[model samples]
Target: MNESAFQAGAARVDITPPLGTLINGDFITHYARFIHDPLYAKALVLQQGKTTLALVIVDICAMPKDLLDEVKIALQNETGLLPQQVLIASTHTHAAGSVASLLLGAADLPYRQKLPALLIESVKAALQHRRPAKIGFGAVDVPEHVVCRRFFMKEGYQALNPVTGGLDGVKTNPFGDEQQIDRRVAPVDPQVSFLAVKGLDDQWISVLANYSLHYVGDWENGTITADYFGVFSEEIGRLLQAGPGFVGMMSNGTSGEANIWDFLDPDRYPKAHFAKSELIGKDIAGKVANALQAIGWQEAPELSARYTEVAAGVRKPSAEELDAAKKLAAESQYETIQQVDRDALRRIYAREQVLLNDYPDTNLFPVQALQIGTGRIGALGAEFFAETGLKLKQNHQPYFTITMANGYIGYVPPAHEIERGGYETWRCRTSFLEPGAEEAIRTQLVELLKAEAERPVYSSYEIKQYER
Candidate 1:
């Protein structure tokens, strides 16, 4: 392969915060206790022809929409690339410091302050590391790691939101009574895809992977971990015996409603959180290795990026609705944390809605499409549901989405999910994007990928042979 035809570079920058930085996984505040593994902002730059594409995956909870836009604009100015050409996404690791300036946690100012500079530096480093490389794209179905957390419940036993006490659309878990769960609220995309770039020396440069399972809660509270995001890279590299300077990243997919919870078997086997994360980490790495064996590596392909912004209005509650929510919040009791935390967060956002209505508010949703030869990607600024992702893949071949991309707008569930009523669509501050946002996102993504792509042709036998 003539590596000069495909130039790829990868770099990583350490971004772990001070030990005391507040962690943002739960309702109660948590501070970084012990950093088991360092967090990083990993970058990969690909250039084919004159077009260039940049991807930065930061290990954190989320990056606010406005902040992400600001970063992209600055990066474009410095690097002389169109703002749309650079895409930054978060790993959505709950145990890491927060960049999501809303909801249950406040942005860790110290970390947030240095984030933009360090991220841009990572990209520049990658550009400096650029070398002729051979790239391959492959997907492996790892269904066992993912489970649909949201469940439609039995008629009489519908759970209630803490604030509204209104019917909870679906039970996330059946609370040990698995029989009460009627069915999964949505479908899951078990396909975990990777883009592997290797230098002319046949050494690994970078491996960019995506999966839909939410952050593994095993590393919650005291420990600051990247969850399984970094583990995927470390394990895969070790298994493949990658050379030095290798970078691996597992970005968050549309997993707002997807998790590792085995709801069907309520009484789960007892295991420590890190142990669980390790179990999942190794399993996923193995899948990546298996898929890599079958990938048809290609050289010299087209590169292009399409970015579009959609104006989605915020879903605001009426004056009367706000007043009712405040009253319920006041009367609500702090019962079990599961119930109490839900009620408290809902109530807090309910008040936010009242205060926000004093002024006009509209959210700018950014959708990005990246084309790297046979690899196609959809990057979104919101925590998208699994069904929405499945829908996108159904429409476009060889495409997957990276969530918390550029920015995060909480959870974006499907239309039916919004109607079903859950924490994700309960008219809260976190999930305030107005309805039809899903359609807008889907409509634009379809337009970008509908064009003739640089997909590699494989024989019929190769296609069927890869589907073990």
Candidate 2:
């Protein structure tokens, strides 16, 4: 149609860790005892005229900047794509292998060592397989699947801060005592935004979807799975009657404060392990399949990307606090922070404080925006809140966010939410970004999206009329 110049390709490489690899995301370390399902680094390469952009979604908890920066350099050396032209993100599945150290769960050094080559392989394969393609954008709202994990407790209920040994106004992931919960502290985002790509012959290529549900973690411990993200890939392919080449990727959105656990109505989900995740994955796939039928395909939609690093402060431990932490950490009977119990949170947080004391006072986190077809996707290097994602969508229509992209900078709650004091706002390496980080990240991303929208490719009279 109308002299098309777009091309696309998709490929996936197994990145599943071997048995005995340590998995992060929880307070304690859990080793991979079995392969419940294989993990992967799925890549999609897009080209329009002389410009090319790549997106890779990996099945893991999180990857720090140092690790990903090395991967980016290798990719650039082999493919000539700049760091800003590539957008790599994690699915944030707690069941996968550790690539970044969080809490007491250390990075699996051997597993991390093997990751770069696999990631590079996926991208190179996708680049070699590029074909003439058409792309479309679609979204659906499935509010029933998302629930805000943070809540305001009733009077006299203590929401303890492990770092300070004091009371917090809000609690996260509270269960059993639902009556003590006054109301949800924040709202959840349920929008499932997707980019659907197909070859000129009408053959399926890939579907890249985004949603804000943090993760569906229902599998047993010591198992390696991609959580619901991998299941969605399978279910979507089956529903669409897609061939083996079809790639279905579900990237995590601003899900720092969202999850599938409905504490107010615990019975709403299945009680069996792995069943809830399967149900959610299939249900979400069904929604995507239904929406796919209505998309308006574009044979030659423009492709562009913008990336920048925004300055954000880190909540490093103060000298006085570090001194106290040293004293408590030394007195603890546990060998590692992972061995500390619920009653010994002071010891666990002390270790986090000592670790954070080595961090810089301010760091630069990446913010990226990509324009594919009529869809706008924003990428952030941290776990952000649902409100931030919703605000971005409201400001820029047909736009969605992909979190834990490029690098990991920890959780970024809104300043107001940080003041409320939940587990996500506690002083730890996982939640060390300053309260103002959200606002700064949001402001930068919005400007980036605006710049992409104003690019010359969409400046023509015919294109302007079609955009409306």
Candidate 3:
């Protein structure tokens, strides 16, 4: 590696709500009454020569596109970091305050307004605390904690989808019986990767780890929690014996189709949500702790980042699709939009966007990729299945992909899965990407990973700026 000067810093800010904050990821909303643990926004800034890059992780459901653009604009104005240079990702903790403004989740306006500033402050704080630091990278397969929630139904085992009110060929857990289940729709991503940055004194400044296990579900009844993301961070920090300035972040990987449900061993989660959360969280911490111990630290490894974007055509409703969606809405008893189930919400969102004919035959968004330390970190603004991450990791071992980064477009299932017709493919307003959209995106991302240029093609990198 080329010898050069390098500096790193990390900072955290509490974003947890005090009380009476809207909570979701469920079908309806309620006020948060208890704090399982506080939500936080953490940032890591790295500087080498004149280049600066920021990677932020927020403990929340999902950051809408507008919120991400707002934070990017604010950081650009304050820190002079280009839009591409800064990547802000959500930890995807469903129990935290809502930033996503779609069905099953709603944005807390006050929380949304304060979010950009807090995120910007984090970037600034990390910059201010920058000091000589060393970086290291390591990853291990830890598939035991996660399982694919989608299952192929055994013949004669058809089940009704709760959200869409349609019979599903494959049953998502909570709907199908184990005796009726054929096999998992797909495999889980077992790889857990960690990137450690330490100060000259040999104490950690920040440790960012990525995993494909979906959020460990448990927080409910307005108990604002950060799920396993927060738990893993705290447990790992303690195990590592991190110093004062240390900030540890555990980000959601490509877990769009994955969940903490272990089909083979259903008895493991027989308890409550928080209890089950701790069981899975500590297991992950144990695996991460062991991985951290075996890593060979690097003093000043190479660091480079690139941001590229492309517009993949949005899947518009065919006449049959439009007719089906219209039928569902017309049959619904929901007198108001608030009462519309999440499944119907998807159909309506798609219909409205198409009726106006303005969603662009294509949806354009940014994909952030950074070649740092010993591997490359790639981020997309859409929800990708574990298969997506697995494909990206091919020939790019140690490569990590963070879905729902920058902005949330919806689920981008592989073409084969799309054909399988599961809830993931149920084109809701949130997951309205066209059927072929996933292939288009994967092609673009693969090309992006191959591009060796220092400066990415910026014209295509359009940050979708708009309002609800």
Candidate 4:
């Protein structure tokens, strides 16, 4: 158990908006909410020998391709690291900064204009903040808090019910068969993994935590927020901090169909359960803390990295479908719908129209794999279903973490779920890819993992501070 075996650096940038404003969709006309006091972009850099890998965690809703590319290019050029070596992940915060132009409506044009500089500065700060630190990993299961949203209907009658008025005899719960309906699906990785770091004096630096549960606690109002990630970070930092300087960076795991909301069993809906998200966050953080207490430190030796983009096709709506969607969107008035049925109906029509051109029928999915000693990290570009993450971990040797929605290319539903055609699989206004996208990603990932396993071992580099 050597404390000096690894060098670590952590930096946090305040990405808070000027005045908590709504950036996603056409919400400016209706609500007036400011960003809460805290929103951040945090980074963790780990080095073993000449090979260094950097993980950037943003509190934003998601990382669109353009913005992610801009950040990646800037960080690579400045840090002298290959673009593929850096992994940028989002917290999937629905209330955070607007990055998706087509989905969220162009970020306040001014905000979009200034974002690149902010992003650059944040990454630079993280790299500059490197320090001698020790890292330890641990995991725990928090089953009661999260569940798979894709409920299979068992009764044939329920499956036959129409999801929309216009689609006659269309099955609502397409995946539900008489035998499978009502069965609860599990997370790809039900375990929460924590990587704890501390300075030479045993001072806490940051805890890099991973969990596979979707973020949907916040609403579509005009507010600058980090949703559950923000709350989770704040709670963890407060609990672990001996003083200021201590931080917590949360990386979203495979959470595609996994959500705190149990959509299948409507009885579990937390309408009055405001504390549910907080409880889930705090419970996981506590488990991470407990895990950190048990692990012994070991020097991480050797590093390898690679990045590839897999083409996942887009989903397109017909011209007539687009017109209908646009018309429905105009009527919704951005008002909150009380009835689940009405809301579901409106969302179906609205999404079909808006996503018609934006959804990817073919997607160039970015999959980056980085290795540090025996530990391996996999970067998945889309909001991956929990099942996919579980499969990767089960198949890959020495897998450390699987971060989902990294450089987000939208949701990657499981093959069977795609046929069901729900919010995640069908929301894309662009050309939707085939149902096999998840398998394709998993296959490529397995190849990367195998390659990493065969690579030769290396050692950590000596830290030498450079004069500015």
Candidate 5:
């Protein structure tokens, strides 16, 4: 091994605390029911010479962009790493801390202030413990456990055409109309891709697993936990030959409408479903370990990593639209919808329109591309639907992994889903990004991929060059 190759160190900090109350879109509060002991916020640090990159994955519910910005700023100031170099991703756990902005009807300021500090500490500890390591990439398909929760149905409750068939005339757009859809057309992609890094002594240091399946697991009691990602991380740690220090970070993929529990089917809801968070965690971890064994160890050097920000147009609500939303929210049967509408009404009545600026139509979407040897890891800003993810993988050849919903800009449904005018689409009271948002994202990713593919290969020097 070269004496001066890149090194990696990982550390996980338990942030599941004295219970910061949790809430989901359903507006029902729930406490953390520990299916497994202890939830965590994990950090993995990679250093190539002086260029250091730190990735922190939190098992919290959706991470607000502002909070993430704060964490990034603190990391940059503390460790001299650029904001882009310090990638912070949430597991989208509905059972974890309450950090989402209040406009979406979820706001807990006390916990939100403390979260960034906790995350920063986790990253600092990981960077402090950096050591020489080897990284390998592998993936496995495990689609059976996950399914798309949103579906299209006619007014009479008959199945509508699927959007995957090029969106010609799908009757319902799941993203646009929040109220009418009764069933989903298909399940989301459930492939779990991972990057395994181990120390020179063969101790597993960090395992970054990316999967597309929203976590709506047994979450009904306002408890602070890591949801399925935490369970998966714990399982991976137990399976690792290394000590408890083995860090596993599960980054959610394109799962805007996908979840372990089928919301439309009450049988699959949290209380009735047989697929526990622990089981989901264990299954993915085992599959990752299995893939690791078959592939063995390979030295992967950081070829190139770049970050870009695109202005994603948000759908703005007009005075009439706001009035209509307030009316619907006041009369809606769902408490969650009512709460959001009531809040919006209060703001409108108080002339507190400035608050809406924070929730504007155009959002700064961050897209990050990291090339490890020949593999690529793409991070998107929004909760992209599965079709967008699959398209990115298909167009970008040799894409080792593509993770969406990293920043969680609500949901980016396919054009057809947008036209179906369902909850995800209608809830956006901001800019109407053309139906081609998915295509635009894919195009940008392809551009990045082409650049990375043209870059020189670095692994050839680490091992005897072998052609695949």
Candidate 6:
């Protein structure tokens, strides 16, 4: 292994939990009884001129910052890769085993305990199989698959805010009701960006794709599947005719306010168990496979990573709100999160208020940037809006965002969206972040990316122009 030679390796380890493990990503808890498809922790490692970077993509809904921090430390001690050099992200699949408590879904203790060792194994295996390789970046617009989940309803329709008991201007997931929707609130990022890695002999080593459609959650609760994320990975590998050693990873992009549902065209989008997910995944894979033919491969491009933490205030409940929530909880007599009525939004959100009141006044959220060849991968610890991601790309081309990476700080809706007061801005445990959190995260991340790519820092005026 020559120190100057660019090399890469890829590996995956099964992370599918046993039946009866809790599956999360919903307002209520679901236990996995049947495994629709196996979940995995996939790792891709790249090295050039003594610089090494490892990216790990897991097929889970989300992992807590503390859990991933501990995993990074173990990886550091074992593989000597610093925490900054290791970029770990969740695919944001709603049907996988729960590792982080969200809404009413508590962490599956048995399944959570197995993740650390398995994640470590995936990376170590990739390290052991490094081979001389080349890399290229490719992107294709696939707009038809992603749609804005949030919408501005018709003027007469009342969009109620569950937390504040007021009318919101915007509504989320207003499924199958186009008559009430005035228009979509946002635009979907159509770009399906990917990084293709191959051995010097042109055999595929790995392909990592990023898209802004959060997840295609067509599966029923209690089914353990990776939604479309796993489908895309497998489909891409098969499309490329890659060997068994080849790996394919699809990371979640800025999709806090987007999904795969088209409400206006209701008849066109009917929910089948896994039919829609498989179709969307393979279609996106086909797009990537076709685009790969034109990529200009780079045998040795620079690899660098930058990581920082920015403090953001938690959207804690006011004293009056907390008092009201306490009264509601006492009246409901719910002993546990699961015991709370899933259909009762007021009761469910009251529990969230009580829990969020205990959160620290401020939290240090992680922001990271990784540069490989001419592509820059930005990582944030929250489910950010599509607008935030698009703003970052304005400052630099060939850039994509990885959300819920390193940790989960809940949803980082833009200040304007917060004013609209939809489900994503309803100030619950799942959406508890300050209004300005989005701007703060994006500003810091853009600076980090500029430094990593050796580009000049944007002036205040330039940033303002970009934001405009």
* Residue-level lDDT tens digits of model 1 in 160-191: 76445578778765556687878887778898
lDDT at 327, model 3: 65
Between candidates 2 and 4, the lDDT winner: 2
lDDT of 5: 0.63
* Tens-digit lDDT track of model 3 for 2-90: 22578889999888876887776654566788888888899999877767778999998888777888888878777788777788888
Which rank order by lDDT, best down to worst? 2, 6, 1, 3, 5, 4
Each model's lDDT comes to 0.77, 0.87, 0.76, 0.63, 0.63, 0.87
lDDT tens string, model 6, 142-180?
Answer: 998888989998878887776888889898888545788
Q: After superposition, how far is residue 446 of candidate 5 from its true place, in Å?
A: 2.5
Comparing 3 and 4 by TM-score, which wins? 3
TM-score on alpha carbons, each prediction: 0.90, 0.95, 0.90, 0.80, 0.80, 0.94
Model 1 ranges off by over 4 Å: 1-4, 174-179, 267-270, 325-346, 355-359, 452-468
Per-residue lDDT of 142 in model 3: 82
Runs off by more than 4 Å, candidate 3: 1-4, 160-167, 174-176, 319-358, 460-468
Instruction: Give per-residue CA lDDT, model 4, range 219-287, as digits (tens).
Output: 535666666676667777877764577668777888776776654554554454335556667777777
lDDT: which is higher, 1 or 3? 1
The TM-score that candidate 6 achieves is 0.94
Better of 1 and 4 by TM-score: 1
> Which candidate would rank higher by TM-score, 2 or 3?
2
